[model samples]
Target: MASLLSLRARPAPRRHRWTAALGVTALALAGNGLLAAPAAYADATASQAVDFPTHCVPPPIAGIPPIDGTTSAEITVDKAAPKVGDTVTVTYTVTKPAAGNPVDLALPADIMTPTGKVALGGAQTGSVTVTGPKKNPPVPGKGTFPPFSMTGTFTVTAPGSITLSPGDYNIHTSYIMELDTPCTVTNPPAPVSQTIIASPQPGANERAIQLGTASGKPGERATVTGTKFTPLADVTVVGRAGAAETADKMTVKASSTGTFTAQLTVNDKATTGIVAYEGTAWNADKGAGPAAYTVIDDTPAPPNGQKLNAAVAAGTLSMTQAGDTVQLTSVDFGKGGAATGDLHGVTVKDFRGGPAGWSLTGKVTDFTGPGGAKIGAGKLSWTPSCTTKAGSPSTCAAGSAGVVGSAGATLASTPNGALTGGEFTAGAKVSLDVPAFTAPGAYAGVLTLTLT
Candidate 1:
């Protein structure tokens, strides 16, 4: 029998070698003598160590595609030349590709000054609405862009003073669309420029006519001056008496500096009170000034018992009088009727022995009614129709009836040295202005006629 020897196995090596080329790790195992390492054990212990990358390189983000579009604008001014303090109208026309979605557009404007560009006080904005096919038929995931054209108008006031020089200026405006939408868009288009001309203020064209004296006696001369008229233009100065212009007129040529002076004499037979003097230059400019002249008794005092008789013609109208005093009683103003009545066939005879002429003056007091209600004295008026005059009575009524003043309006008068004991006949009409809401009561007033 073979001698059997028992042997204990030793521990394996603590460190192992890894071969990168063979992709295996080698381990050494200790055993008793005569034991050769098995090939299977050595193959199992040899294992390869594989290394992996710790950091990774990320991919890039996807880019957004740009939307192609175009923008254009045109500006026009209403006035070719603008003056200071003038309102300038700016008309703007814009054309742009409209996105299917609603978009806001900004219009930035500035005035091109001599120094530089100055921004406008208020900037404007416009809206573009994508409608019709662009809005109704959606292109799935893609946005709709449509072409559009629009117009807008605005106003700008020029400077009140001469701060801005008189020359050609440009109104510059940039049209831009807001890019806050979902799709990426291109930059806005170029700006638009419009030209305007500014002009200096013109001189005054108003002509002025002045009078030396506003009022003077008849046959008095008044100096008339005119300025700011057309140079070397013919200026006619005439006196207008009542409704008729006097034949006596003066025509003078304006000086080189547009100034003229002339003398206008009042007619000796001119009507008392207001007399209008008119000045006309170059048939385009005209001015008028009123002059009032008073006619008073400047002669010697007449003797006592100077009688003045006023009467109405028989068979025409009844006349009531108290010692050469004609009374107009019972003026009936009917309900809602005209405040007018006729005092038929009135006559006056002046027997005063005086060199100066005499006038019939009507004095009216307030119309007093019951309950202390009164109508104004100015509301009562009298119109004298002097139809017949003997001894050349200077009748106040020439073409129309003379309006009687409440205090002492001239009704009829005798010409100077013409009333040498003569009679003047006149037809009279009286009017009383009554309000619609007048109280229904008896109203009474006194109208006294005196010679002056």
Candidate 2:
């Protein structure tokens, strides 16, 4: 399903659904030995004094005058400190629109959804648009427009402090003249309305580096292996023969497993002793560390060239995910809302080749509304599946259908055995079932996935 760049509720056939405009509060990763309780967002609330120019869309009729006003917004965020890549909710409450002059108006209370953009600065740049839950009260002759609010969500892409300030906004009136007002911020607040610090994403990949041969002659070809490194990052490996001389520079990209192999000709002039291999990455936290190799004298080879060989170590078990967001496109009263697409697969690799078994489970927090109303977690469910990779056992089974809530529900399990040492991907079709009487608004929920 195609995702809307931003959702602003217009006159639609659906009557009771609130557009999902804001990010959910918190997300936790579960299971022992895994990073737990990593908050996905930072919580904050602030009121800023602001001034903007209102472009009151003129009506077709000659008698009615256009609407204009100066305004300020109170900004609120649910998470105070979030991890990078996590989505967070941002809300804005604006002071009432003071009319340009007095006039008679019949404003529709349910149809006109406010839309606008909030400027962002500091660690993250760009704006979050507000287009959501619609409500407007009718304005009697010379009467005041009440305070109005809008909500939207943005995913934090980097780690550091972010500053949010009020920006352009709009107000739509469904009166006889169809007057709409669009406001542009001329003088933004001195200090930003909301500032949240974001921490680094948890469970970053980094593991022991490997080399094809522990000892090899100078100017020879050798391979390097590694795991648990950042995925899809560019890596450069260098071989140094001595304190003053460099040997070779080989560059390659990390595989999905965060693994890479770079083969280079050892520097011909490299001192005949020990050589060091060092790796570096531009985008990841750390690169494969340095390793040592021996360079031998230029001895003549046997009838068949001497065999260049090395023993490999037992590998470690690891799990990886493709991405972080899940989307549920529409919600209804009885049928609720089903997620639009299949979750990106979470893969588990044993590589350990041992008898240890593993299990993956998931649970979700209740869905929360902007006004503090909630749709319970029990309303959500999923249909799960697991598929084995080339070397994986055909035995790991996907967990049964899950009614996700506060308690844990199994997602996939591998039984204890030697054959259990395989790789597989687990995924689900997540959904929500909202009650008819639930308040209409965009709701957010946290999903926690755990493995052991």
Candidate 3:
């Protein structure tokens, strides 16, 4: 062997072989993945205007009734190009003021600036409540209300199109003592809907696994090793030979280290060609793998670098309830009175990426008490609410405040296309008016929830 100085003196290409190989490999990769396409709605500013009706009771002067008025809101998203993990600032400005309770007398300056919920749907679900600047101004019998603007910031956690809308709010005022006059958006002839698009971070690399085997003859069996898959998950390996397909479509469980080996049998009728094989593991616990194939007779090698695909199961529309039973807090009716309690939360899971919306309704049977005393279901009322799970495709809205005693009442619902596939929760505050003549006993009623 020559000395180090002598070895260096030998003539060499300015570019090393390893460096050149990497460059060629990178070029090949660029043609395969183009994930940075700009979003369609990447404008500098996105804003929406909505006109809706609200009903609120004016601070009680002993005989005042709830007032109805129209309110306009302008929803604005500050960032034009938002990405996952970015803090996005959103502002809700009252274009037209909502009417407060019309007091018979001048209301004192005891009302706190209002706080409202911002409803979100589409690629993202859930709402964020933000408080406006505190300013209490004395109002004559009838005055403009909710003129303050509120700004809330949320961290963008997922990439997709998310929609934002306005929801219920609470405004408080003092007549004798501080009391809250709640307001709800009864209807929106034209609801203000704004959408923002979030993009994936640059240079995001997903874990990849390779599957393969050397050239083989018709009806031959091959075993391929797979790595970098989910640890201890069940995996299915499928082999295909060009257009003439059907090879070893078999399942194998990964070791604790996430590595798996699958054996495939080449189809007896496989034509001679380069076959492609793909492996997938959709639910780990379920180990449910759907088979897709194209098989071959066999061809030359080194061997083609095959693709290992792991796809999510196209599941059905379903729900998994954690608490199937509920024991409401006991209420003491010292004197004949009404009892109020909250209903337990139920979950909604939709994986059917369809274009249709879904609704959840509750119909309660009449409550029966001791000695056969009966209470009508119409006496029970619920204020509905549906909370969206993070990363849900659409936002769910609360149902109207009504009793289930009718044909049936909506507990919570989502607009058409709201639940392409995601999860949310439905719950409500329930009030029961117990008759004074009923005897004291544990009353029971069946709350039937229907999903369509």
The C-alpha RMSD of each candidate to the native structure, in angstroms, is: 46.3, 11.5, 24.4
Candidate topping TM-score = 2
Candidate 1 residue 334 C-alpha distance from true site, Å? 61
Q: Which prediction has the highest lDDT against the true structure? A: 2
Q: Each prediction's Cα lDDT score? A: 0.34, 0.55, 0.51
Q: After superposition, how far is residue 354 of candidate 2 from its true place, in Å?
A: 10
Q: What's the true lDDT of residue 6 in model 3? A: 4
Poorest 10 consecutive residues by lDDT, candidate 3: 1-10
Candidate 3 local lDDT, 226-246, one digit each (tens): 555567765665543322234
Tens digits of per-residue lDDT, candidate 2, 273-378, equal 2222224422123543345555554657778778563332234456777654443455554444443345657777765433446777766655555344566768
Alpha-carbon RMSD, candidate 3 = 24.4
Candidate 1 residue spans exceeding 4 A from truth = 1-76, 82-89, 92-207, 269-452
Clashes of each: 4, 5, 14
Relative to the unseen true structure, what is the C-alpha lDDT of residue 227 in candidate 2, on a scale of 0 to 100? Answer: 71
Clashing pairs in 1: 25-46, 25-47, 98-146, 100-144
Query: Model 3, residue 329: what's the lDDT?
Result: 30
Instruction: Provide the TM-score for each candidate, comma-separated.
Output: 0.26, 0.54, 0.39
